[model samples]
Target: MKTLLLSLKDVEQALSMEEVISAVEQGYISYNEGKVQQPDIVSMEMPENNGETDIKSCYNKLNESISVKIASGFYDNGKNNELPTMIGTILLFDGRNGAPLCIMDGSLITGIRTGAAGAISSKLLARKDSKVVAVFGAGGQARMQIYALCQVMNIQEIRVYSEYTEELPKYKEYVERNTKVKVIICDTPEQAMKDADIAISTTPSKKYLVDKSLVKPGTHIVAVGADMAGKNEWDPEIFKGAKIVNDSIAQCISRGETRNAIISGIIKESDIYAEIGELLLGNKPLRESDDEITIFDTTGMGIQDNVTAAQVYEIAKKKGLGKYFEFI
Candidate 1:
């Protein structure tokens, strides 16, 4: 059997933010409806190097495909090795015969799918009149989140906060160049979040970056940083009286910000409002009131990778985008 090899550029050519958002939305619905088989993430930590790696896999029965992703985060890579902080690879397989179908770069897939999740959640939970956005972090994922959000919301201005001040100008320029949204660089998280309609956190900070007092009553918060245990960005108390939604209840309860809130005794497991799928499937209510504060806690899910990678594979095949080789 022959397998296809897709490079990062090829993957990028095959995907658009809008298509990815739709695919990820359906992936979540499949997950919620018990149409996908996703196992618990296997994680490894290298404390000495301040690095961690996670292995995630999912089989989508609806698509008849399986995807396995190995993603790593070396927090000091840029400072020490002048390399990317996050790197990943994914393998796509035919579910029926267990034959390898494709091998592709996963970094872009991860970023887009994660950004799509944030956008999907914001679309369903954020107020329709939301215009001002506050973004925490100034990295690739941060850029992706803003780009995806623009597809769903009529954002007017973006307030950005990052510890690395040097990247702020580049992030601002990128946003202004791509989406023409006004960008403001803030020295503090509170300043960025002040009066913002939607706030998004995409850093890998181990310490909490947002305080409960900074959040307004009508603001929608997307917590994207805490995908692993001990990594957190929001104060546990912020979850109080807020409608909490998660991408995956099992994953979030184990590693996302929801875990932190549950561990801190600020909220219980039953307090969670619904998974993103429930909202997409119309099984639950969306933002009921403009004054209601909503939080979307996503730890990232394997099914997102499965459906996205499957779609990318089909697109690449139609475009003759990837190299083919016999492996077996």
Candidate 2:
């Protein structure tokens, strides 16, 4: 049989933010319904190089496909190597026979899928009139988050706070060139989040960046950085008495921001309001009022990669977008 090889550009041509958002939403529903088998993530850290790598896999019964992804983040790559900080590859297999079907670059898919998750959470949990967004990073994922969010919310302004001040102007320029939203570079996390309706953190900091006191009522927070143990962005205290939603309770508790909260005794596993799937399936209530604070903790899921990669592969096949080679 022939296995297709897709490059990053090939995968990009096959995906749209709106379609990815829809696919991620369905992935969540399938997960909640027990239609997906996602294993625990395997992670390795290279502290000396300031890098981490993760392996995630999932089998989706609904899509009848399997995806295994190896993604790595080298924090100093940009500064020292002049390369992207995040890089990855995805392997897709036929669920019926376990035959490899496609191999594709995973960097773009990872960013967009993650961005889609943030957008989906905001659509389901944030207030409808939310116009201002506070973003806590200025990397590719942060840009992807803003791009995906623009598809769902009528955002007027984006307040950005990043430790890398040199990147702010470039980030702002990119956003303004692509969208109509005005971007404001903030001096502090508080300045960025003050009165913002939605806040998203996309950094890889080991320390919590947003304190509980800085978060106001009626704000929807998306915690995007803490996909592994010891990586945190939101203070545990922010989770207290807040409506918390997770992409996967088990995964989140083990590695996501939810882990920090539970470990700190600020919240319990029972305190989790709902998984995103539960909210989508109407098993639990969404934001009940505009005054309620809500948070979505996502540790990244293999089902997300599976469903998205499945779609991308199909599209690549139909369009003859990638090369094929025989593999026995």
* Global lDDT scores for all candidate models: 0.94, 0.94
lDDT of 2 by residue, 149-221 (tens): 9999899999999999988999999998887789999999989998899999999999989988898899999
Estimate the overall C-alpha local distance difference test score of candidate 1: 0.94
Where does model 2 exceed 4 Å of error? none
Determine which window of 10 residues in candidate 2 has minimal summed lDDT: 75-84
What candidate 1 gets wrong by more than 4 Å, as runs, is none
In model 1, the Cα lDDT at residue 56 comes to: 98
Root-mean-square deviation per candidate:
0.9, 0.8
What's the lDDT for residue 120 in model 2? 95
In candidate 2, residue 238 scores what lDDT? 93
